[model samples]
Target chain A: MKLLYFAWVRERVGHPEEEATPPAGVETVADLVDWLRARGPEYAYAFAPGAAIRAAVDKRHAKPEASIAGAREVAFFPPMTGG
Target chain B: MAVRLQREPFDAGAEAARLTQGREEVGAVVTFTGLCRRGADSGAPLTALTLECYPEMAEQELARIEAEARARWPLADALVIHRHGRIRPGEPIVFVATLSAHRAAAFEAAQFLMDYLKTSAPFWKQEETEEGTSWVAAKAVDDDAARRWDEG
Candidate 1:
């Protein structure tokens, strides 16, 4: 799957997008966030617990528990500030 | 209905005119423009604002919001245009225009579109000041505003 970061999350993660394969047990958005957090200090900082992060799976807004099975893209970002 | 995401600035007046050009039956036209301001969070002068978005997702999300507004209101036409990239203070960042047969529907639908766009759209804004730059944090008030639409 392709993982995307935006706003400060992208700045912390140091990149906008990347390809990654999660472990078999990583089934939901929260699990994937945990997995990314373990990749490095930057990823950890970006996905740190209590961070105001939001997610979208396949271009749709999703909650932490939303399933990501067979998804092509997942995006993580701060709560949107658009108007 | 039209939703456009662009990097260039948009003319709000032209957009509003296009929406109501030949539509005599439209009694109300509500147009809203959101602009970048000169002040930062720290009371410093903000030089510019950098706006970014997931291109495909932003377009899809805006379309979804526009569709919802149409579903809830009897709209004759609706147009949404949002700009991304570096914008100077006093420059327009977004424009929304809604036309209907009555003032109530046009006014409410335009507000609904803006409220949802504030919270759900896939755009992020970063403010640049003399000291440094920082991402603008999302406000709880915006979430509350969006949520109010769900209740009776």
Candidate 2:
């Protein structure tokens, strides 16, 4: 799946976008987040200790508990405050 | 309604005129242009700000937001333009204009667009500071502002 970062999310994650194939257990957005958190210090820092990061599946806003079974893309970023 | 995402700052005056063009009933025109501030908090000297957004996603989300605004108000027209890439302090970052027959509708729709844009748009700001580069997070105040719409 294609993963994207925005704003500070890219800064924290150290890249603007990337493609990833998650492990079998990563069936949900939460699960994918957990997997990403375990990747390294930067991923951990990007997710932070317990930040309320938001996710979007297929360009529509989604919650962390949302399923990612057939998702082609999942983007994670902090809440937006732009107008 | 028109939704535009550009790297060049927009001319709000020209945009407003264009939106209201050929509309005699549009007695009210309400607009909001978000400018690059020093910083949201302590007024830290803002050297530069960079905005990044997904081109396709941003356009789709913006169209959805504009549709919602029109559904909720009797608007004559609406226009939203946001600038991305590197920006300097005091430069315009966004422009939202609503035209309506009455002041109340124009005002409400304009505010609604701004509120939803803040939470719904994909644009993100990176602030370059003396300490270092910092990613600006979603502000609690912005959420509060959006929440106020639910009260009615």
List, for all models, the DockQ compared with the true complex.
Answer: 0.92, 0.74
What lDDT does candidate 2 reach at residue A74? Answer: 90
The candidate maximizing TM-score is 1
TM-score of chain A of 1: 0.98
Give the CA lDDT, 0 to 100, for residue A54 in model 1.
97
On DockQ, the candidate that comes out on top is 1
What TM-score does each of the candidates earn? 0.99, 0.92
Which ranges of candidate 1 are over 4 A from the true structure? none
TM-score of 1: 0.99
RMSD each, Å: 0.7, 1.7
True contacts kept of 2: 0.74
Instruction: Give one digit per residue, the lDDT tens place, for model 2 in A10-62.
Output: 77899988999998989888898889999999999988757868888988888
